[model samples]
Target chain A: MKTYLLKWWQTIRISWSKYTAYRLNFFLQVVGPFLVFFFIKYNLWSSIYGEDTGQLIRGYNFDEMMQYHVWTLVISLLGQGYAAMNLSEDIRLGRISSYLIYPFEFWEFHTAGFLSFQILQIFVSSVTLGLAIFFGFLDLPSTMTLLHGFSFTFFMGFFWFTMQYFTGLLAFWLEETWIMRVLLSIVVSFLSGYIFPLELYPEWLVSGLKFTPFPYMSYFPAKIFMGVETNFMMGYAVLAFWMAVFAFVNHLIWKKGMRLYTAAGM
Target chain B: MSNKVIEVTNLTKQFKSYKKKPGIKGSIQSFFNREYTTKKAVHDFNLEINKGEIIGLLGPNGAGKTTLMKMFTGIIVPSAGELTINGHRPWERKKDFKKKIALVMGQKSQLWWDIPAMDSFLLLQKFYELSDQEFKTRLDYMAELLGVVDLLHVHVRKLSLGERMKMELMASLLHNPDVIFLDEPTIGLDLVAQENIREFVLDFHKKNGTTIIITSHYMADVQALCKRLVLIFDGTKAYDGPLEKFEKILGNEKTVSFSFSEEIGGCDFIDKYDAKWNECRNHVDIRVPEEELREVSKKILDLYPVIEFNTEKMPIERVMKTLMTNPEVLRQQRENLSS
Candidate 1:
C-alpha cells in the first residue's frame, strides 16, 4: 500500500513539473480563459441591460446577474477545467505503450496527472474568487454556503473527468476527438446556464434540465455560491448517479478500445 | 530443469485496416461501405530463447519485427497461439510480468520530454518500487558508465539524441529486468555513438546476464553483439542458427579484392575464379573457395602487379545484403537442402 501511494505521489510530482515547465504558458493557460470569458460576458450583459441598471430579468438585476456570472466562472475553473487532450493524443500517437510496459497502470498515471491539475486549478480559482470579491463583482457568502458550493463543485470535477476520459478513449476508433469535446463544451455551456441564468429560460426547459445533470454541473453550484439555492441533497444524488453511469460506460469503452488498439506509430 | 526465459508456440497477430482510395469521391464511398482487409503481421511463429542469451532478430522493413516486440512486451495482445515470458503470459499484463521485462525502441522516446530526466527517473523508481539505495546505486553506476551524469538534470528535449538515448537506456535498466527487448536501439546516430551504445549494452548484459533480443538494420550491431541470429521473412521465421553458420549460409566462399599498379589484360587463370574487373582492368574482385584461398592469393600475387589485396571484413553484412535483395534465394536454398 505504501509503495502504491508512493507511485501515485511521485507521478503527481512529475506531472506538476511538466505543467509548470513553461512559466508563461502555464500562466496563460490557467488564468487567461477566465479573464477573457469574464470580460466578454461582462460586456455582453452590460449592453443587453443598456442604460437601465434597475431592470430585473427573471429576479436578477444587472449587479446580481454579473455576480452570478462571476460565480459561474469560479465554478468552471474549479470543476470543469481539466481536459483529456493529452490522453487522446497519447493514445493516437501510441505513447501509451510505455505505460503498458511499466508496473504502473495507464489509468493510474493519468489520474495522478488529473489530481495535480486539480491542485493547480484550485489555486487558480481561489485567486479568481478573491479578485472578483475585490472588484465588487461578487459578495461574500456564508461559511456553510461556501463549503457546500466548493464540495459539490469538486465532486462534479470527477464526473467531468470521467466524461472526458470516455471521449479520449474514443481515439482508438475516431481520428479526432477534439470536435466531440468542443460540442460537449458548447452543450454544457448552453444547458448548464453558464451563458445565462436558468431562471431566464422558459419554465419547461428549466424543469427538463432539472432531470439531467447539466443544471447541477454549473447552475446549481453557482446558485449555491450566490446564496440563493440551499438544496444540496438532490444535486448530490443526481450528480452521483450520473457519475456512476459515466464511470461504468468509460470502463466498457476502455475494455473494448484496448482490444482494438494496434499501438499504431510505435 | 530446462533453462528457457521466453517460450512461444504458433504465435500469431493479425491487423485489420480499411482500404481507402484517393480523392473526395473515394473518401465518400469509403465512409459508406468500407472494404476491410485483415493482414497477418506475424504468422505461426515459434521460438524458445534460453536464459542469458542475446538473439538478433533480423528482417526487412514491414516484416513484423516491431509488432513481435510489442507482443513480447505486452503492448499488444496476440491474435492466437501461446507465448510465455518469465513464466507469465505476457498478454495478460500482470504486474509481476511487467516488472520482469523491458523494451527499448530507438524510433520512440519514452522519456518525458518536458521535464528533466532525473524527475522521470525518480518517477520510475517509485513505479518500480525500488529501494532508495538500490535506485541511487544503479543510477550512479549507469551514469558513470555512459558518461552522462551532468546531462541528467537537463530537460530531455534539450539534450542531444545520443545523450537522450543513453538516458533512455538507463531508465529502462533501472529495474534490472530479467529480459530486455531492443528494437533498433542505435538507429540514426553517429558511428561513435552507435559503438558507445553497443559497448554499454554488452557491458550491461555481461554484468547482469539478462536475456536480450535485438533487431537492427545495421549489421554492425548484430556483428558486434549477437552470437545467434533469427531471420524473419514476410512474417515467418526463415532462419534460426548460430551466427557463424548464418554467415556461411550461401556458401563458404571468400571475396578477395586486388588492385594492380597499372591496367593489365585478364588472364584465363583469373577468369576461372569468377573475377569481376574494373573499367580499367586494374582492379578486380574474385570469389574463391575456402580451401583454395591461400593458393589463389599466392598465384594472384605472382601473376599480377597487386598493389593491395584484402578479404571482406564482415561476411554477415554481405550475406544480409544478398538475402535482402533476393530473399527467394534463401527459400530455394532451404528447399534444396531439405531435398
Candidate 2:
C-alpha cells in the first residue's frame, strides 16, 4: 500500500510540474475560458431583464437570476471543468504504449492527473467565488449550506469524469472524438439547466429530466448553494447510480478497445 | 531452470484496414459502403532466445520487425499463437512481467516532454518500486557513463535528438530489466552519437548479462554488436543463423579489388576470374573462391603493377543489399543446400 501510494504521489507531482510548465498558457487555458463564458452569460441575463430590477422570470428576480448564474459558474469550475482531450490524443498517437509497459496502470496514471487538476481547480474556483462576492453578485451563505453545496458538487465531478472518459475511449474507433464531446456538451448544457433555470422549462420536460442525471449535475447543486433546495438525498442517490453505471460501461469499453488497439504511428 | 529467456510458437498478428479511393466522390461512396482488407503483419513466427544474447532482427521496411517487437513487449496483442518472456505471458501485462522488461523506440520519445528527465526518472522509480539508494546509484552510473549528468535537470524538449535518446535509454534501463527491446534505437543520429550508443549498450550488456533484441537498418550496428542475425521477409523468417554464416549466404567467395599504377589492358588470366573493370581498366574487382584467394592474388601481383589491393570491408552489408534487392537468391541457395 505504501508503494502504491508513492506511485500516485509521484505521478501527481509530475503532473503539477507539467501543468505549470508554461505560466502564461496555464493562466490563459484554465481561467480565461471561464471568465469569458461568465461575462457572456452576465450580459445575456441583463439584456433579458433590461432596465427593470424588479422583473421576475419564473420565480427569479433579476438579482436572483444573476446570483443563480454566479453559482452555476462556480459549480462549472469545481465540478465539470476537467476534459479528456489529452487522453484521446494519447491513444490516437500511440503514446499509451509507454504506459502499458510501465508497472503503473494507464487509468491509475490518468486518475492521478485528474486529482492534480482538481486541486488547481479548487484554487481557481475559490478566487472566482471571492471576486463574485466582492462585486456584490453574491451574498455569503450559511456555513452549513456552503459545506453541503461543495460536497455535492465534488461528487458530481466524478460522474462528469466517467462520462468524459467514455467519450475519450471512443478514439479506438473514431478518428476524431472532439465532435462527440462538443455534441455532448451542447446536450448537457440544454438539459442540465446551465443555459436557463429548469423552472422556466415545460413541466413535462422537467419531470422527464428528473429521471436522468442532468438535474443533479448543475441545477440541483446550484439550488443548494442558493439555499432554495434542501432535498440532498435524491441528488446524491441519482449521481451515485449514474457514476456506477458509467464506470462499469467504461471498463467494458476499455477492454473492447484494447483488443482493437494497433499502437499505430509509433 | 531453462536457459532460454524468450520462447514463441506459431505467433501471428493480422491488421485490418479499409481502402478509400481518391477525390470527394470516392470518399462519399466509401462512406456508405466500405471495403475492408486484412493483412498478416506477422505469420507463424517462431523463435527462442537464450540468456545473455544480443540478436539483430533485420528486414526491409514493412517486413514485420516492429510488429514482432511490439508483440514481444506486449504493446499490442497478437491475433493468435503463444509467447512467453521471463516465465510470464507478456500480453497478460501483469505487474511483475512489466517490471522485468523495457522497450525503446527510436521514432518515439517516452519521456515527458514538458518536464525534466529527472522528474520522469523519479516517477519511474516509484512505479518500479526501486529503493532510494538503488535509484540514485543507477541514475548516477548511467549519467556518468552516457555523459548526460549535466542535462538531467534540463527539460527534455530543450535537449538535442542525440541527448534525448541517451536520456531515453537511461529511462528504460533504470529498473535493470531482464529483457530489453530496441526498435531502431539509432535511426537518425551522427556517426559519433551512434557509436557512443552502441558502445554503451555493449558495456551495459556485458555487466548485466541482459538479453537484448535489436532491429536496425544500419549493418554497422549488427556487425559491431550482434553475434547472430534473424532476417524477416514479407512476414516470414528468411534467415536465422550466425552472423558469419549470414555474411557468406550468397556464396563463399571473397571480393578483392586492385588498382594499377597505369591504365593497363586487362590480362587474359584476370578474365577467367569474372573480373569487373573500371572505365580505365586500371582498377578491377574479382570474385575468387575461398580456397583459391591466395593463389589468384599472387598471380595478379606477379603480372601487373598493383598500386593498392584490399578485401571487402563490410561483407554483411553487401550480403544484405543483395538479399533485399533479390530475395530469390537466398531462396535458391536454400533449395540448393537442401538438395
State which docking tier applies to candidate 2: high
Q: Which model scores highest in TM-score?
A: 1
Per-residue accuracy of model 1 over B1-339 as CA lDDT, tens digit each: 679999989999999999999999999999999999999999999999999999999999999899999999998999999999989998889999998899998999999999999999999999999999999999999999999999999999999999999999999999999999999999998999899999999999999999999999999999999999999988899999999999899999999999999987848898888999999999988999999999999998998899999998889999999999999989998998999
- What DockQ does each candidate score versus the true complex, computed on alpha carbons? 0.92, 0.88
B237-332 in candidate 2: lDDT tens per residue? 999999999989988999999999998774788877789999999999998898999999998899899999999988999999999999999999
The lDDT for every candidate, in the order shown, is: 0.91, 0.91
Q: List the residue pairs that clash in candidate 2.
A: none
Clashing pairs in 1: none
Per-residue lDDT over A82-117 for candidate 1, one digit per residue giving the tens place of the 0 to 100 score: 546689989989998999999999888888888888
Chain A TM-scores of each predicted structure, in the order given, are: 0.96, 0.96
Best by DockQ: 1
- Report the lDDT tens digits of candidate 2 across residue range A1-266: 99999999999889888988999988886667457756798888888899997988999999999888888878888888654677888899999999999999988988888888778788888878887888788898999999999999989988888888988889988968999999998898888888898999999999998869998878999999999999999999988999899999999999999999999998
